[model samples]
Target: MKVVVQVKLTPSPEVATALEATLRSCNDAANWLSLRAQDREEDRDRTRKALQSFAYAELKARGLSAQPALHVIRKVADAYSTRKANLKAGNYGRKDSKRYQRIADNPVRFRADAAQSYDDRCLSWQYDAGTVSIWTTAGRIRGVPFVGLPGAVKTLAEYRRGETDLVHRDGIWCLIATCEVPAADLNTEPDGFLGVDLGIANIATTSDEGEPFAGEKLNKYRRRQIRIRAELQARGTRSAKRKLKKRACREARHATHINHVISKRIVAAAERTGRGIGLEDLTGIRERVRFAKPQRVALHSWAFAQLAAFVKYKAARAGVPFVQVDPAYTSQMCSWCGHTEKANRPTQELFACRSCGVVAHADHNAARNIAVRAEHVWAAVNQPHAADTSGAPAASAAPQGSRS
Candidate 1:
């Protein structure tokens, strides 16, 4: 399992200046190489080797040491590769579309404060002392004090590998290091599943007697943020713009913290219950559903993907068996008697099954449905080759290795 640990650097004024200069120099070089990449792409020869051969010598002469210059070349190459992939994936619409043409015509440009990658040779961590020794244009700066969560620092110290990225965002300097953490063995042959249903009204609802993470507070906060943003936009001043940026970041952090809390609790419950975790595969949901302008604002404001991602990684790390099932009729279908009807849901909060005469919370009923389908999906996938996979109704799990 790969995880990222971030630490903020507290450096002297001189050290900060040197860091700023280093970033500017690297990005300036990158912009220069970006144009070269565009020309090479035009020539139908956009290989990294070709660009390195042509530009590496000049970059060294242009005041970049060696690794930084090489990184600049690779970064530009990666940007172009990403652009190409996005184009191929039809992310920018058709070839004749303006969005596609604009992207294809423009060259990749790196901002001065954009993140720069540093290998082990250029950056060294002193986790015990909470300091780092990093290479800058001014030379190797040692004893740059840093701060991070104690657990994160410990993980970085023990499992940190590969490159660390130095990112400058909102006037803050932080280093994000990649750590290769070992995942626990998956819990095969689970007794049952802890089903989770995600939604806007309730952030998460569980099937185990219904633990609902309400989104009322978050929705109120978002509404407040929206009003403040509207007021700030009306001002159209520099300070207002700055405040908007800060508020945007604050809102995102608040939502992210809430998601982390919710995901941790759900994963912990599954681990303690001796059960697997089941979830709905909500891929392409936004594209599949349309809403009015006001509803769209509410729907798109929250980070559904981030929440799901947190649950998945946490579940994997805890050795809890996890599976996602098709969510075609989880809400409409009755968990008691497998009854499917629109009238089963009398209200947003109530589910009255006509067939089974079972009354339950709408979210709880949906969660139970998801759990049943996930169990069947997991069994079908784990069954022997001769076993009929098509036996499970309205159930299909994503392909995965035996160990997840």
Candidate 2:
């Protein structure tokens, strides 16, 4: 199992200025490369190499002497490639335009000082406990202590696997680590199964077999963000822009902290239940329909994917099962009668099956339906192959319909 531990970096003001300057240089180099590439005279790899070399020279001139991280150049190139591809595909949506704008404003990133050894190119030095330490702060943090990284490693195996990514935020940097654990098969399993419903309003509603966990703190933080953003939007000055950026960082940091807490809670619940988790296969919810303005923003902010990812790996570590069930009608179907219809979801927070007269809280009803689906899947998986008449079970045989 792999777990990540992040520690804040405390850099002197001078160091911060140097780091910011290097980032600006990187962005400038990337912009130049993009403009030069328009001529089609240089290959993509050549352009990327040239940009990296330019970034290196820029830092050296500033007395930093840091080597440019290839990842930085690759990311800029990828952004440019994406823009070209989208233009060719004619996906000229506002969202795509906003993505282009984001890429254009990012700063240049370097691996380490150019004077450092090849192995130490990306690592920064930290003064702590009356000693100097080295750490890789390329992706994470402006400055952070290096000694904290090794303590978070779950195993030597993970270190050998080399799946750590460093990230920077709030003028500090830290390591993000990934570890692989064995997965459970919920379809052909012996243990019980858990069904979970994710949503913007409630965050997550699980089968009665399991308890529900909501991101209330996150919601509170989001509300604060709204007020801050509104206040910023009302201002018109350079100071206002600075304030807006600061507000944005505050919102992001708060959201990230909440996400980590939520992840830990869900994982702990799964471990307590000793059952494989069954979640909705919500791979394309956003693409399928349009929502109201506030609703759309809420849906996008829920972070369902991050929740799934956290549960998956945590379940693996705990030797619990984790699987995804078809989500198409899970919420609209009646848990009692299996009758699926939009009318069953009679209100925002209520589910009333028109046919069966089954009524319940909307989220609770959906959670129950999900649990039933998981149960059926469990039964099918446990049944003997001799009992199976078809290569795969028929969809009609599976429970169908949802209300909300």
Candidate 3:
């Protein structure tokens, strides 16, 4: 498994100036290569090598360093190749003028290879001792301090160091290190499954146990941000625009933090029970569900994808298997009975099965159904003959009320 750990870099005034200069030079080199590659319209590998050789002397004279220059060339070439491939596959239209312009204005990305640039020297725990150093156009900058190294990152530092990216954001510099960790041994098939239902009202509802993680606070926060953004956008002043940008960054960070917390709790619940985690496959849910304008906006703004991703990665790390089941009928269908009808869910929160007289919270019912379906899927895959008898998968079969 791979994870990225971002550490803030605190450099002196002289080193900061050198870093900016190096980044500018690298970006300029990348833009030049991008234009040349686009105009040539030839094979990518051939073009990349030719461009590298063509620009090597000038880049070296500019004090950009050899490996970093090559990194820029490769980055631009890969981007151009991807765009061309997308166009050929009909995924992108011919009227992609905006995309073309954006490519032309692409900024410099300064990447440091562990081998070439850092010489395989990883950040040490003694970062506070000011012994860490980084190479730059002006020379090596030693005694750089890094802040906020997460526990996971500190552990990863014990292993091999990989490539890192130097990113400049909002007047701050951060080093994003890509670290590889040993994959968890999730070979043990779970005895059962814990279904998780994700929604705007309740961030997550697990089938097994515990109170649902409510999203009321998060919902209020998002609504406030939405109103604030709209007000700033309406003003259209320079200061308002700046505030809008800052607001976006702030909201994104807060939302990511919330997702991490919620996902961790959900995964921990499953891990405690020695069960695999099941989630609704809500892909393209927006297009599937119809709602009023206000509700549609809220649904669109919901970070279901981000929440699911967090749960997935965290579950993997904890050796808890995670599976996504089809969400169809999970909400309307009664978990206790095979009965399926919209009347089963008369209200948003209340779920009472007319057929079996089963009553439960709507979200909890859906979560249970999801868990059952996931277990059925696991059974079908492991025992194909079990499904062959019915000529249909167990999960796809209409729910029959629990046989007494």
Candidate 4:
């Protein structure tokens, strides 16, 4: 498994200047390559090679490294490839086509790649000494102080040193180290599954034991931020604009931290019980559902996608199976009797099935359905031929209840 651990760096004035120069040079090189590649669209390899050879001596004279320049070329190539793919997919007719066209016309901005540009030969970390030696434009910066080395990061350092990204954000320099860890002994034949229903009211509800993870706190915080942002924007002053930017960053960090915590607990719960985790496949949900203006804003701002991504990575690291089932009727269908009806979910919180006369919390009902769906999927894939004496798939025996 690959994971990134970010450690804060404290660099001297001279070292900071060198780092900034190196990043600027890399960005310039990337922009140059992007423009050249567009002109020689039919001959990508030739253009890249020619640009590399031409920029090598010039970049070296500017105290920049060769690896970073090459990395920039790769980044530009990837961007162009993505644009071409989108164009071929007929996305050129979309509103974002103008944005794509602008990219084609201008130089691509190069974001610093801490790992790709890192000269392994020139970079070294002394974990016990709390220092890192890195290559920079002005020369080698030795014994740069780094703080807050998490226990997990220390373990990864012991195993192997991978690529690290040096990012400069909001006047802070941080090193993001990507490390590879050994895979866990996954329960391939998981006894069952823990279903998780993601939403705005209840962030996550599992099929197994424990109360729902409430999102009220987060929702209230987000709404407060929204109101503050609106008030600041109304002023349209320099200070308000600056405060808005800072507020945006603060909100993002807070939400991200919450997602990490939620995902970690959910994955841990499944691992503890030796069961897999199941989730709804909510791709393109925004396009599928319609809502009023206020509700639309809430739905649009909801971090469902971010939550799902966090859960996926955490589950993978723990060797827990994560299954995503179609979410079409998972919310409306009765989890007890498999009865499908829109009337079953008359309210947002309550689910009362007409066919089975079963009553349960809507989110809990949906989570149970997700769990059963995952079981059915797992059985179909792993035990295709395994059947009970009644000649039915073993998955049919899955418990049909809201709390399952």
Best by TM-score: 1
What TM-score goes with each of the models?
0.93, 0.68, 0.85, 0.87
What is residue 263's positional error in candidate 3, in angstroms? 1.2
**Each prediction's whole-model lDDT (CA):** 0.84, 0.57, 0.71, 0.74
Off by over 4 Å in 2: 1-5, 24-35, 41-121, 124-168, 175-190, 209-211, 215-221, 374-404
Candidate with better lDDT, 2 vs 3: 3
Q: How accurate is candidate 1 locally (lDDT)?
A: 0.84
Residues 1-404 of candidate 2: C-alpha lDDT, one tens digit per residue? 55444444455565555545555555555455455444454345445666566554543453333444454455556666676576556565454587554543443233332121212335433333412233223333333334454544334233323333444555564444343434444333525556678887777777653435654655676767777777888887789888888877776666566656666666566667666677777888899868999888778755678777777766666666666777767678776776779988877777888876766767766776665566556556656442432222233432333433
lDDT by residue (tens digit), candidate 3, 274-293? 89988998899887888888
Clashing pairs in 4: 114-164, 114-165, 114-166, 115-164
Could you tell me how far off, in angstroms, the CA of residue 392 lies in candidate 3 after the best superposition? 11
lDDT of 1 by residue, 234-316 (tens): 99999999999998898888889999999999999999988999888888888997877876787787888898889999998
Q: Where is model 4 more than 4 Å wrong at Cα?
A: 41-47, 90-100, 111-116, 159-161, 387-404
Ranking by lDDT: 1, 4, 3, 2
Global fold similarity of model 2 (TM-score): 0.68
